[model samples]
Target: MAAVGVGAFALALAATWTSGPLATGIGAAASAVYALVADLLQPSQRVHAPGGALLRTAAGRVPRFGRLDRPELAGVHPADGPGDRRAPPPYVERDAEPSVRRALEDGGFVLIVGESTAGKTRLAYEVARSRFPRHAFVRPMDRSALAPAVAVARRRRRAVLWLDDLENYLGADGVTAPMVDELLGRRPGRVVILATMRSEEFRRYDAREESRLTGSDRDAWRVQRDVLNAAVKIRLERHWSEAEQLRAAAHREDPRIRLALESGDRFGLAEVVAAGPELLTAWQNAWAPGANPRGAAVVAAAVDCRRSGLRRPVSREWLQDLHRPYLAERGGPDLQPEPFAEAMAWACQAAYATSGLLIGNYSQGYTAFDYVLTASDLPPVPDHLWDALLALVEPADAYDMGLVAHQAGRLPRAAAALERARAGGAAEADFLLAIVTGDRGRPRHAARDLLRVVERRRAALGAAHPETLAAVHQWAFFTGESGEARAASAAFVRLVADATAALGAEHTDTLAARHQQAYFAGEAGEVDTAVRELAALLDVRLRRAEADHPQALAVRRSLIWFSSLRGDLAEAERELRLLLTDAERALGPHNPHTLAIRSTQAAFAAQAGRTEEAIAEFTRLVSERSRLLGHDHPHVTHSRLQRVQGLIAVGRGAEARGELTEILEEARRVLEPGHRHLVLARSLLAPPRHEP
Candidate 1:
């Protein structure tokens, strides 16, 4: 049928050479016939394999059970018989096996979270094979492979989406909440999304108080959180239970299991069998004086590269360039390091019938072993390495590194990495760079950069595209932040109308614009109007979201603030007290929203003629904020300024002056010269001298 359709298409094209109406009609009819046949003969994207065995995926070829890498495993290979070379180790059922099997059968998102060498992947593999023997597998290689693999899996009557190291698929171009929702929304028990993540990475993504995240980081974290919430999480402890140990003892006929049982007192049976401690011991011994010192340096460099946010492999040249610093720090000339080529060889040499400290060849680049990476409790990536990595890493990697730096509060390093990413043609780098610039106190600069982003996104994604609209939203926000509140308010009004028209009034983007419109209107001094609109918006938000939802809380806070502006101080205070209680209960007292409410309550007390009390509260809050969020955090700076004002009000000019000086220095170190906090601090430090 497909061949016939192709022939008909060819005939139709040939018929177009004739100019008569009859010929034209015949060509059109034939073209339509070919289209019909072509549609009928379209090839399926579904996986094709015999029942009872998983095979290929849309992402790529699937590795069989024995071929799968079991991290840190060392010892005799467990085979079916004396001569069988490709069989896996004897199966020891875990305590979570029944639950995991049930999750697979029930089908949604199943995640196994554990530390390295905890047998997470092995457990998942065993359960999936036994429970869903006929289900096809789709294993994405990276974020880029995820969507296509999912689409391909959806075509199958039953399939499994296998994601290992879940963090790799979580970010801007990665697995998102909407994607997971779409997959689960389809035939409920047909496709099971199976994933594994290290415990540390899971906690980072699972952080509840994400108020420290800004801009794109906040958006990405929200997506990750939503996906995590939807998953049936199963925690796998590194230590084996008594029942598990007994099960391993049953498999004692397998020498590997016997050896593991003997040494498994400290680590789990799986860990000992996988040679986890042996690998760690080997790596440490390599760093001894006159040992594989250069090779150890190479391993250290690779580990630090990963720690610094370089996920992909690094070239031999890159490692050679990085290892020198590690050598220098480890008594460079005194140690008399081996030659570079010899070091590379030693690092890649396999030990304990398992992987080396570093893996990969000279031509293909290298990456550190997972065991080494997880075990090393290294300090921060050196300044020199940050610069070198930013210079050497690919644009996409550089962008991710910038995000990591930004989240860690390393503003200057983030700017440098994002700048490099932008230069290397990573488009979203501009958006993140603008945010970092704003955080550094250059809102004007951020606004200009956002304008560029807006133009680029509009050209590429169209004016009404959600991403373009987001760029426009940020541009308007920074414009207002740069002291053009009226212009920003006008922009938000236009955005609200456009978003409502394009995406409907209740769409998240539209509501976001409306929220911004109301707040900026208040900033522009239309207090009564802001208050009225915010109240209406809050009602809509409460209906659509939980009362404790961040958006709803924000709207409520804005409405209360504007109501205070309308000379309703008592009502504002009452509302704030209620809000403070709710925020503390729902988001914890240390949450940013809760702290902001506390700050507002303190300010309101001062406004209501309790300056001394307000000053004392501000002082206490400043210390708490500094302790929890670091001293250079913007929240702490704002609180300090408020405290200085309170001190000046109480005739403590001497103390106020000293505090103001410190604030000025901190602002200079972390903020832009034009930042409002920096400008205010300078004014307080050098008040105008009056001429009598």
Candidate 2:
């Protein structure tokens, strides 16, 4: 018991530290004196030993540790999780098996932690088969039914909770959230918790979870800490010894292969051991006939929605559309219904892989990783990623793929893919196209899409539904951008009223609508109203949000612009400098918001006749933006044009003309024909192209 208990929670050992010394050993007389002292000094000094054969006690008998060395564990193949029809044959006992079994014996919670695909699930299966024949596997996607699941498990002779992906479960169904509480509430030997957590998710588990705790949740918080502290943590490593690798392949003729694979940094072998040489691809082939179209579509959708360290939601409808062509087989002259069983089989396999990329729901799909697992594991993006995406995805799924490109600002790729989507009966892609239109500097065109989005949502959902109101608010905001300031102001005024009444005034969406309404007042020639409303809003924003919140910084930018308009150059300059410094610190110098501020500062300098200073600032802005957002991007071109203006202001019109010609030519090639920057550049080239 002692040998198996190595590194079993340091806190437990610490608790026992003074107890031995405190219990003075005259057997009876000294023990009585010690008891009296303990009662006087520490009323809470009672230590309950864990339930184990070893009397650590106030515990039930500790279960015996079964034999855990190689003989029982070794097999030629991989093991299956619960209910697997053909779990690969169990392999040589993982070194982790003993700890897992021992941890379960002492019974509270055991976390099997490891990197993605690092054999955590495989080890778990071995532990479950050897120890717990009846256990409940709790998953995040099935969380709504979690209470019934635990209730069912608790009915059994020996209930074991098999929880995997603890991080996702933190915010899942009700029972899953009270996981630690439930574990501690149970009698130790009566129930045991076996769980696995990806190391990265586990590292951030507290951040995602702890914030939800209210001030009134002190007891829950304490129990959570105690549960985590009491958990027997087994961290699985990716390394395998030369002997083990060779022995794993003992039936093979290759002698040197195992040695080479076991050598330095062979991450590939970990994937092989965990899922096979083609971990993810193997599933596709294995489930091909059963899930011909469904699984592939799900995989593609997941691939398209990859985000960084955050799960992106994908709709089930989009996945269904992708699955259509394969199901119906129109080209084959036969219209057939989708094979419900086949699609379901794939869905089950995908969602149930010990730590699969996707977690399925009837209405949606979720990836535990922000990016597709395979793409994330690859080398850094090559220069031609756009080309790669276009080549990799099918034409039918191109709209979803295009939405990814559009949202990410890959305009050229976004344009092509979106055009394909629009052609393919994907009406939703039109909304994304509108956003792309606005981004490409044709706000009026974007306004049309925004209107459609608002109308469609308003007609389908009620006017006060959050999604409908959100769409309305977006339409309202777009009017100001479309150069309809008076219309924008009126729309926002109505929006602010609607949002404030429906949602509370302090809600983020309401506040934003209020802020934009205030900004629209200025654009509509109500400067005093804009100034007063923005000033009050800025104070509230600064108080409510973080120090450098985007809204507050935007408010500061407005104040500087309006103050500059009122000819308060000194005040405007001072505030702009502070805003620039704070913005740069908060959101790196090359961030789009920070660069916008820089452009504003440079324009202010030029307006103030600080020609050289403006030129210097604009030069740096152009160079930094070109690096941050490619040379042909509108952001860089705008800065380049501003720098050209600064040059012309300093009596370098000849040099300005040269730079202007290059920018205009690039604008002609890369930007929309009537894009604002192109219009600005052409105006600068007109007669009386005087310095600003």
Candidate 3:
């Protein structure tokens, strides 16, 4: 009985041990079953990978499975080597062409030139393989490595030496006369040299050499045409013939080709042909049955158009017209649903790639195209796919859209997009939301949200990140604008210090911080300190950013106002006139900032006994302001008060009194009685009793 009990316990222990793995296996099997069910449930939304099998097969064929066997060549082809048993270079198939073969075999030196991405590097590889089948094709390891490469070539009795992207290592900085001399002086029998370079790179090399190809001037090609003239030069132009296009289309299995051919819209056929065979092949393969070919054709068309110099963000009407016939041809107005969807997707991608030319910061004006590209492929989407969509969307508009929705009290949509952006780890989204939450009239609850965004951004993007720094500056500016002077001052001080350190003391960001610091310092009751800071910042900006630059002009205007506050009217007028002229030139007439600066100058002139000049300036300013910003605007009221002061300065007491009364009435109507401008107008009227 004891033996049987012990056996039972052992059997139970064995079952327990096996149960964990069995449960894992069952869980994995269940997951697979669910995946299949999910896939079947959504046949319309599936992603297929075609080259995956081929890539896996190629990966397996690699000798070491994952790592390259030779350390010197790393994981690239063995022919791309410098340190192994100097084996012969790999032969390129293009060598089968007699002219190219003869050039590689007999030419003293060869200069391979082509545009970027024009197969120049591949051609160089082929040349190395054919010329030195038994010798290892060693490439220059670095700018310093060129010498060692030359030495190795000398040691090997017969070798084919290739310099891939040689222009990068042989331009002005990369080349020295001594290096070239050494390379050229080496025996021709032991070393057959070849180098690949772009057209622009060749120009730079020619410039350095002062007009000659130093070592082997006998074998140089100015243009791709020059290569064609050579016994070995092979020019690979874009495939344009119908046969070539058809072959490419067949390779890609793109159904659109048939549709396009059937549609008979031939206006841009030449442009389409110039996109090259490889692109056509890619589209065909991507669009074949079972392949989603989402935006392949659209992207291909856009790329083709751009190469032909037609700016991107092609009209939707143009794309529709181009693809309509193709669609009609495929199924006579009943094309397969999947293929139709794929064609639209391709067009959207093309539209995005060509839109606005990737300008600085924002993509200027392709809103329609970006919208279509972003809204596709949702639900169980890959992270990279989501990121690619976002990258194509303009950030400023995305921010503005979120803000507009938030301001209109459309919280759900705003929150949804913001949450999506946040989940996707976008720093700009957090910064923009922080701005929205901190704005006046927002609920007190929003402050916590703003702070949360601020904290998250600081953590993710770092304290000195440009966007993070801008957000912090905005927070401080908003605090000051909203009447929290102390908090604003503290925030400004920290921001100024950080910006000064990170951007360098003289950087534009540092100067902007200093300008804000000056403003906030005055607001916080440090007027004298503010004046000193503004003066220094203005001087630095004038010298560095140029006096006419917006930042420098702004700083100068600030200095003028600070000077007026300190009772320095003469200095204020001097600074004001200089800023006004520059502002007029830079910002144009009727700009609010320019008008404000002019008004400040008028006040300074009135204080300095230049009444006539002040009255003329003020009258013009008041008229413009009344026309531009209504008669009741604060700036208009301010201009009226300046005119009254100018009249008083010239002893026109009656006119001054009348002007002051008008200014007071306007101020009373547009501003509070105790407001600074109203008080100033009342005081100016009190001083005058003399008639004109």
Given candidate 2, what's the lDDT at residue 449?
A: 77
Local distance difference test, candidate 1: 0.72
Candidate 3 segments exceeding 4 Å error: 1-452, 605-692
Runs with alpha carbons beyond 4 Å of true place in candidate 1:
1-87, 94-113, 127-163, 169-195, 202-210, 215-249, 255-296, 330-353, 371-377, 455-464, 486-522, 525-674, 688-692
Candidate 1 per-residue lDDT over residues 1-692, each given as its tens digit = 66565755655553443222222211122333443343235322211212122223122344332332321111122221222223456878999888888777778899998887688888888777666656765665455667677887788777778887787677546676678878877888888888888886676554334444543223324546667878999999888999999988898887777877887788877776666677777767877777778888888889888777776667776887888988888888677677776787677655554445675443234778666667756677788888888887778788878877776656777789888888988748888889778766677889998999899989998999777787888888888888788999999999988888888999777887888888889999998889889989988978875587656776788898889987879999999989988787777887666777889889998889899989988988898877665677777898999888888878899999999988887778777567788878877778669999
Instruction: Identify the candidate with maximal TM-score.
Output: 1
Candidate number with the higher lDDT (2 or 3): 2
Instruction: List lDDT for all candidates, in order.
Output: 0.72, 0.54, 0.47
Steric clashes per prediction: 3, 7, 19
Best by lDDT: 1
1-692, model 3: which lDDT tens digit per residue? 64345434544433343322221111112222333333334334433222111111121221111221121121121121122222322222332234455667653455565543333554455545545556534454333455555666667656555555553344112334344445546764455666655543344323222111111111112221222222133443222345434543452333333332332243122223112222334444554444433333334333322222122233332333333333333343232335443354333232211211111011111112111122223122222322333344334223333433443333333444455555555435664454444332232333345566557769998998755666566666656655566677778789888987787888655667778788778877788888899888877866774676656666777767876787867777776777788788876676666887888877677767778998999999989977654566556777887777777777789988877776676566545335567668777767548898
- Residue 660 displacement in candidate 1 (angstroms): 6.0
Candidate 2 per-residue lDDT, tens place, 138-185, comes to 222223334554664465556555555554333212233246556556
